[model samples]
Target chain A: MQLSARNQIRGKIKTITLGSIMAEVQVELPDGQQIVSAITRNSVETLQLHENDPVIVIIKSTEVMLGKQA
Target chain B: MQLSARNQIRGKIKTITLGSIMAEVQVELPDGQQIVSAITRNSVETLQLHENDPVIVIIKSTEVMLGKQA
Candidate 1:
């Protein structure tokens, strides 16, 4: 699913999914790191994502709901 | 804020920020719309975001904390 929008979140893909279509990534910064929780697989195919691939992660601030992992 | 990761979320930028560096976007899908709430500006510049630009939004499932907007 290709989208033409303007909200891009760029970061290094610290990790990829283990079994299912999922992965963990961290956004590098001059100060610190903004580690995000999940990255979907379908998105990978749509975005043609790969390891070490310079990619952008867009987040609607409102969509950024705070929670703790189990 | 440029990042080389593998988790890319693709979607359309429904709206941009009014005053502050903020915006609201909607991701199109085969079934329904996954209306996420917020998109940050720094992430935008990092990815060189522009209007109608195809971009990816990376979300750590853990980071996806569910909540209501006030």
Candidate 2:
């Protein structure tokens, strides 16, 4: 399936923290940089994700904000 | 103002294409890499953005998705 979201970063799941409704999944890149993602717990279950799993970080352009320095 | 977005990239506004309701904004980084953002025209007007303006690209964690390789 085609994705409209333009930004895609490859990384490995470093950790998964589940909350009541949301889940925080940390993805560590090969370069050692980490990104945190907060997704629905249901989506996490649907994805069957676990630590050390390879995944792509998908971010939609519509959700992106352009901020100017104040 | 404080932002909840976890991912922020420093860039400059490269272009802006406005539609009836939405607008596509292209931000160019120092190394010449570009990121595209689809934002509401209302936000574009609120920001008073123009080409070549310095801006930061913001992506929130909750909106981020993890895509597993098939």
Candidate 3:
């Protein structure tokens, strides 16, 4: 799917492998970039992600917001 | 200051420059890395970040969780 915003963070599914109770997910970005993140093994089986699947990476500005909330 | 987590994401305040209504936050990382993110100009002024200020980057596994949320 084409993104409306250029810098909007998103990921392309590369592969998923089981690792004990955790799943190692490899997500690719535009220009062949990739990052590996771990998640629940169940989530991986549930999602059933395959090679070349489009996925969104959602991040709230506040989440990245550094500072004490008062 | 020291980080307990080896890969804990954080930023070192490099500089903040005003740009229109936005503030360009230049954050540096270890090994001489950096990423520029834009925030409200007021936030910069409010935070009063100076050189070498430590800032945390919080990201939930669910947020980077690829696939649709159910």
Q: Which candidate number has the best TM-score?
A: 2
lDDT of 1 by residue, A1-70 (tens): 3322344555666555532666455555334566564655554555555566555666545555688999
How many clashing residue pairs are found in candidate 2?
Answer: 0
**Using DockQ as the measure, what is the rank order of every candidate, best first?**
2, 3, 1
| Stretches of candidate 2 exceeding 4 Å from the true structure | A28-34, B28-34
Regions of candidate 3 where Cα sits further than 4 Å from its true position: A1-8, A62-70, B1-63, B68-70
* Ranked candidates, highest lDDT first: 2, 3, 1
User: If candidate 2 were superposed on the true structure by all CA atoms, what would the RMSD be?
Assistant: 3.2
lDDT of 2 by residue, B1-70 (tens): 8776776767889899999999999987665656789999998999999999999888888878899977
2 against 3, candidate with superior TM-score? 2
Evaluated on the second chain alone, the candidates' TM-scores are 0.45, 0.83, 0.61
RMSD of each: 9.2, 3.2, 7.8
Give per-model TM-scores.
0.37, 0.72, 0.44
Q: How many residue pairs clash in each candidate?
A: 23, 0, 0
lDDT of 3 at B5: 23
Regions more than 4 Å wrong, model 1: A1-7, A65-70, B1-70
* Cα displacement (Å) at residue A51, model 3: 2.3
Q: Poorest 10 consecutive residues of model 1 chain B by lDDT? A: B1-10
Tens digits of per-residue lDDT, candidate 1, B1-70, equal 4332344556665545532576455554334466454655554455555555554665445455678999
